[model samples]
Target: MRIGIPQGLLYFKNGRLWKRNLNALGIEVVTSPETTEGILSDGIRHSVCDLCLPVKAFFGHVLALKDNVDCLFIPRVIRVEPDAFLCPKFIGLPDMVRAAIRNLPRIIDTEFNIKEKPEAVFWQEVRRELKGDRKMLLRGEAEAISTNEILRCAQNDRKRRNDKIEKDHRLQKFSEHKLTVGIAGRPYLVLDNYLNKGVVRYMNRLGVSVVYQTPEKNYIIETMSMLPKWIYWSMGKEVVSSVRRMLEDESIDGIILIANAGCGPDSFMTELIDGTLPVHKKPYMSLSIDEHLSDAGLQTRIEAFVDMIERKFKYN
Candidate 1:
């Protein structure tokens, strides 16, 4: 059976793993096309008026795939790890889609709360919900885990190689005109080109190198330890920790915070990050995006932010 996976929300983070698991189970997966004006428009048309931009985009993705697939895999992810939860929207996403959208294929809205149950249990629940073969499910889980480990190691190795290269005096001349700016936000907003109106590419065109990385686990723990209160949202911790890391790094010239216009967690996280910036004395800007945001306006603001950074570098 063809199962459709929408390219939105947690899809940015867990899409690969989900695809790997399903493909290994001998199922055909049909993913919606990348975000486009049409897709976002479709999303906005069907979704509630108050929904965040990402959720509206997600609705569009679901509509894109509803007709092509026999079923949809939109899991209700509550807690992936202990002591942390996803946003309230994510916990209620499947139901929201059901309520808002009409005439959808069968939804595989399995609840995934690894905090309460082991990951193996979660997989078993998914297998049962999908009616997938038990052996194939186990095989898929194993393969996904192995692939994740390899990718993690490769990313670490590449980061180390890049660090070594950055330290070399020969490459310093090449970076003279480039300003490294750290863009911190939810993966969905930061990584989705159409959703963010190609901000990363625009920054590149303006001679600004953008960096967005998930900080290592130890670094996240260390950074969050200094906060007055713990961040309970998984994505919030990542954004906070990554921003802090970028602020502390002397090589990164500036930082930008990207957030959906109505995201509650982001509202708090951005303020928390902003409070720390005065001490670091780093140039920072926050971009709040919605469906109504204009491409030209975003570009103009980015150009101005980059100009300010360039002036700071020149005078300092």
Candidate 2:
């Protein structure tokens, strides 16, 4: 059977896992294309104005895939980790899509909460949905998990190598023309070029090195310890910890915080980052994006931010 996966929300983070798992189960996976104006407009048309930008984009992706796929895989994700929970919207995403869009294919809206149950329970639910053999399901899940772990290890190793290279270069001499900027945001907003108006590419074009906040387990624990209360949202904790990590890095010249217009967690996380900026004495900019954000406007603001950092580096 062909199953469609929308390329939004947690898809940026877990798309690979889902695809691999389904593929090993002998299912054909059909993914929606990257975000484009047509996709965004279609999503906006079907979605309510109050919904966040990422959710709207998700709706668009579902529409794009509905015609071709046998069913859609919009799992109701609650808590992946033991300590952290996802946003409320994610828990209701399947319901939201069902209510907002009509004339759709069968939706495999399974509840995936690993925090409460074992991983085998989720796979059992999937097996029931697909009516697959138990042994095959077990094999597929084992392979998928092993493959994901291998990828994670390789990524961590690459990051360590890059970090070492960056440290060695810093000790040599600082480049006059280049500046490093840390970007903190949800993967949907930061990685989707169409949604963020190609901000990463624009920064690269301006001769600036861009660093993304990928928080490690130790970093998250240490950073959250400083706060009075815990960050309940999983993505929020990641963003806050990433911002803290960036602030502590001497090489990061400035920071750019990106969030969608109507995201609640983003608002709080940005505030927390803002509150700590004074202690670091770092220049930072927070950009709130929506369907109305203009490419020219975004580029202009980034140019100005880069110029200010260049001036500070040249003088001080």
Candidate 3:
């Protein structure tokens, strides 16, 4: 069967895993095209005004793939961590999509609440679909995890190589000095070039190495233990933990959190980080992105932040 997957929201982080796992089961995976103006327009037409750009983009992706695919895979992700849950919209995303769009392919929405056993939900839901292929499911899970790791390693290597090249070129001006900035946001906002308006590129051009909130798996797990028990949103907790980790790191000169306008979890995270970081005296900037946000204003704010960091730390 051909399964359609929307390339938005959690897809930025888990798309590879889903593709790998589905392909392992002899299923053809059809992904929606990257975000574009037409896709955004379609999404806006279908989605309510209050939904964030990423969610709206998700709707667009769904619409784009509904005609050709046999099934649509939009997981209802409840929680990934123990005692923490996902955003309400994320948990109810399948329902929202069903309500917003018209006729579509069969949606395969498996609820993934990893707060209990790691593979309990996977085994329970996947068993229903692939009743006779227990071995395939096991193999797919392993392969997906391994594939994701390989991709992440390759990305980090590429970032390192690019940073070295940029640093070598700027050596004469600053003697190999570069500011390290930690970026905190949802995976979609952090990774999507269109959604973030190439903010990472801007930071790299400004001679700063950008460290995302999601670090090595072990590092994130270890650092999360330091956070307060009340920050309960799964993604929010992770972002906030990353911010705290960056704040504790002496090499990180500043932090810029990109929050989506009207995102409750992001708003809460921004406020939590803003309140906590002041005690450490670290430079922190929070920028909100919405459909109304402009490229010029974003560039100005980023340039200003970079300038302040440079003047304060003498880093290039």
Clashes of 1: 0
Off by over 4 Å in 2: 132-177, 277-280
User: How do the predictions measure up, each by TM-score?
Assistant: 0.85, 0.85, 0.79
lDDT of each residue in 153-187, candidate 3, tens digit only: 43564355423422322322332337878777887
Candidate 1 lDDT, tens digit per residue, 213-240?
6787789888778888889999999999
- Itemize residue pairs with steric clashes in candidate 3: none
TM-score computed on alpha carbons, candidate 2: 0.85
RMSD of each: 5.7, 5.5, 6.7
| Runs off by more than 4 Å, candidate 3 | 116-124, 130-177, 215-229, 314-316
lDDT of candidate 3 vs native? 0.74
TM match of model 1 to true structure: 0.85
Better of 2 and 3 by lDDT: 2
Where does candidate 3 have its weakest 10-residue lDDT segment? 166-175
